[model samples]
Target: MPPRQSPAQKLAAKLLLGGEWAPVTNKIGFVKRPVDQAAVEWRKWVQRSNFQTRDGIGVTEHQGTLTELLSKLLPLGYGTRWLLLETANPEWTAVVENTTGDAHFQYVLRHHLSEVRKIPTIEVQDEPKNMKRLPDEMARGRWGGRNLTVYDEAGFRRSLSLYHSEPWKFHHGGEPYDFEDVEQYSAPRALDCFPHETLVHICRNLGLDPFEEDFYVPNGRAFIVELLHDGKRSGGKKYTLAEARAGHDDISVPAVDDPVIGNALYPSGSGNPNPDAIFPSTGFESYARPTPWDRAVKEFEECLKRYSSYPVRASFSDGLEDLGIIALPSLSSGGTGSTDISVMASATLLESPLAIREYTAAFMILQWRQADDSSAFRSFYPNRKQMAVIRRIYKEQGLYPFDAGSNEVYFNLAVDKMIRSVTELRLTKELVDWEASQPAPSTAEAAARANRSCAWDIRMHIQEREDEIWNPELDDRA
Candidate 1:
């Protein structure tokens, strides 16, 4: 089984973001391993200064003394401080540059230093025994001109002396000064003036720094200040905090009348009778409904019926025959009966050539059947003669072969041959059976007996031969 992960490992896995750093409550910073070159350089720098690393804690070598390495490094500008802090331990350095630290720095520069500078310069003596020290370094400078202050060790130390002054009072005048008076003469304030307390409030509002961590305060303070500054400005009206809050309430509050109810006086509920009601209060009214035109409707119905007519399945020959019928010229009524008959015959003859052969065969079969049923050949001679004449005329016109003589001969011969064949095949067996029933002892009877015996023997021999020839067992299996 695999090993179970520790709670800390599980948390670390879940907290892993795409970036190289772990987010802390105070600020965002990268993690630097002890073996990293950058970390080594930072360790060296810290060691060279008044700070030391002991048991994972960044301790000052001068312990309890006001001479902190970071305090000395702050005047060099925030960027330098940030770089050093990040290099020292990027994972934990956020504690210094966060919103809280930012605000604290701002308070020191803006409020504390501002108050200190109000002290008289003449009273800011190096020897405290002779004269009282000024609250800030600006007071220690020569009177009445813009005095320059360096960020080096001497300048920082001098600045510290001013900070150390009690209530920032001048000895000669016995007067105490506030931060406002001192800020008037001070240099431009640093961008990192976020206060720690303000940062805590901002973090709480954002729900990010619930632990009130000191490291994240500076970052939160800066974020808050930026948000406030960048917020949309009210057009012309300069709004106080109270006024803005009141205006927001006014915009969000509900109106007095209920919009769901139907009330004409109040102009609510779609300005009509209630939609939930089955019928309006005004009741129902009647209006004329127009009828469609009868002729137009009938014509449309007729067109629809025509379009829906049953489809007939036809071959190409059938379609061509139909086209011929549609293209044919119509007959006139002025002609005699014979002329009309001739014209009709010519038109029928011009119809599909394939259909004509089938129709002719059917007509011949019908005539033969009629002659057999009625034994009235003489009476039907006129019709038969007319057909023969027509056939002869068609043959003469080069429409068909002249085969009337062969047809008559073949028909007579077929009648006689069919009678003979049917009598021989069907009646021979009955005749033979009748002869076998006669008495014996006479010459005729003996002749008949001999013939019957011969026939029986021949039949028996043929049956035996057929049995041997068709035997299934005689066939080869292989």
Candidate 2:
């Protein structure tokens, strides 16, 4: 419980706030402090006033002690202290112009806590405000002419102040890109359109951190995409098709890690090998150097040679592994493997260019599926052309015998059945139920358990296998 304010302190606060504090009291005769409400109004008024002069919040003798009272008070929520300090100190007054009063107060509070509750230097300047004459050691930011720079005994900057005036790039998992390209304009607008509260809700649903820059927006987009494409009514502000589509478009494209390295990491081995380059500890040297496409083709051929005689396993863990395509959540001891040749065959076909494209497209489509909506799983809906593509690709790889139409029929049935199974796995309540059954030691442990059982994690695992199969450059053998 907060310490009760004295009548004198309450009157002083009311004066500092510029009006009567409409205090709320319960039937038990407990008065609820009007700090939050007062802070809001006080902030608005302060924004419109010149707070640099001494005649700011300290207008009256009682109000003059407002800052002193705030400094002594507990449970005022940083907002109240911020409101008091914004007027009491010229530096903080300048801080209010660039950032929310709450944010500036947080920085101050953080420093105070870091120093074991010992306050940093707090000086009152009676001279007129002049930006140019401010000391070089003063900590300030570029946005507002307020420098709050504090130095330690070694004359080193001690505060975590953000001073850059450069425009921040809108990043999901990478550095901000120039939005001059017309096609790229949709992404930022989509981000701006969604309310912060909605983003928090979506992040919560996705089992993602609401405050993490990389996790929040990307995962929120996925949840939002399901809402939009499933024709379900979204909570909060309703968005148009254009807004939803733009958000979906932005979300669908995978963010690469370090594009420069991504593009150049696997350049042709044309340069002379470094004499000092350490050979494998196992005494192995490069026997062959194949391009990603070549390596993928070789892996597919090996899969055909090994698994074609036997039926493919329906369990992804088994089928993919047997086909020399390892994925996440390795066998995990005693897991059953289903013998579904077509699905195994499909995994083998990933090395094929057409198969890669088809698989990627299907995964993207599956990603949009809502757990409750059957219509969301329309990505693998079989068609004559798609079936033909699968058949032709398999035949071209020599996995299917020439004139063996029976194999084609088996492939179609297997693929359709596999798609249904995967969809069920993704949408089923088993993972959720399993997670709910577990006892966790802490909130963090519970969150980790939730992430492990999340539908998105499963989907990403499957997607990762596809990525490995498609990019043979990542294969250990390659």
Candidate 3:
């Protein structure tokens, strides 16, 4: 028998018991206490209960499906998938409100895949140069705008090689030498055919030290000819007689059989010491022997002709718009701004192709706003009139204070001008309508209008006159 229980103990034990209340049976001749009865009832209640299921937590069945959807939807993880989802169904929030997280994910997943699929692979544009970590000079101006001094002699020589050699062959290493193989007799040798006298004359006139100086010549002809002259004067050979007349050879001295004077022309009378050999030997290499100099000059000049051109800033001309580059399509006479479609199309050309990404992004923002029904911009968008104003402003003023260096600023101004034009049109319309309704005034009234100190003063006087002449009842004033 359990210990006899008090009323308070029985109540406490009854409270601890989990299941419905039940009457306890007593064993024959042995009376059971209330606490023992309660214990028995609690044990029975525990036996009847079942374990709770592990749902709505980690690694659940729904999570696997959701993960699958996420993987399928975001294979590349490119672009704003949510914006694309919003585009597909504006009321997508309501559609998924009562649904599971997995259901909502599936809806987004389907829309994302569909959106990405529609975008042809060819439509993907390369990221702009300005977006990346480009060199300082690359972002400065057109390729031609870089300073000439940026190239050292070695770099210039390499660039020049591209002009003389087949560029692909030189870089990729083993294409046949073909046209640049100057060893062939029939191959066009520009310097070899050039008049020696004329070449020397040009070199001298240009203040060049044909034997030792390196200068940037604009043409290959000049380059090859200059080098030929240098070769002719390589030894102690003077370019002219002592009296300063133009001639190729020095023949004033006698001949000798010395190995140092090997096979070279000397003055008459064999076996006499050669006076022409007065100069020290410059090894076997002469300025006349073509090795490095002629080749260097020819290649560099060819490169200059092939790779570089005079830098040109675009200018306005007939049939070409002077928006920035002079050779682009014109935006004059409300051309691109004549309609909403045209405005959207033409705004892209306002910036360079390399810098057009910002303009594209801004234009997309406008598009997104119009697409969203809840957006304030949907009703009061500044496309047509703003574009018209932009066109008019460009035609009248050109791109003021905007040039190659300020592309981002130019894009901002274009958008800002569009917004300002919308408000300007609204105000100008009000002013015009107000002016039309007024009675014809005397010359004194006209003079008074003209005599207003400023535009603000003029506006205030006009408003005062309108108030004075107001027929409140007829004008619908409430």
Model 1 Cα lDDT, one tens digit per residue, 374-447? 21123222233334543454454453442224343223223222222222212133333433453342332123
Q: How many residue pairs clash in each candidate?
A: 15, 6, 3
Best by lDDT: 2
Model 2 C-alpha lDDT per residue in residues 345-434, reported as the tens digit of each score: 233334334433233223323333333443322433334544454445445545444233443343323333344445432322343343
lDDT tens readout by residue for model 3, 412-453: 333332333222211233433443443443333233233212
Reference-based lDDT, residue 295, model 2:
47
Q: What do the candidate models score in CA lDDT, each in turn? A: 0.23, 0.25, 0.21
Clashing pairs in 2: 139-147, 139-148, 139-149, 140-147, 312-341, 314-338
Worst 10 residues of 1 by lDDT: 222-231
Query: What shift in Å separates residue 294 of candidate 2 from its native position after superposition?
Result: 46
Per-residue error for 440 in candidate 1, Å, reads 99
Better of 2 and 3 by TM-score: 2
User: Considering summed lDDT, which 10 consecutive residues are worst modelled in model 2?
Assistant: 22-31
Per-model TM-score versus the true fold: 0.13, 0.16, 0.14
Best by TM-score: 2
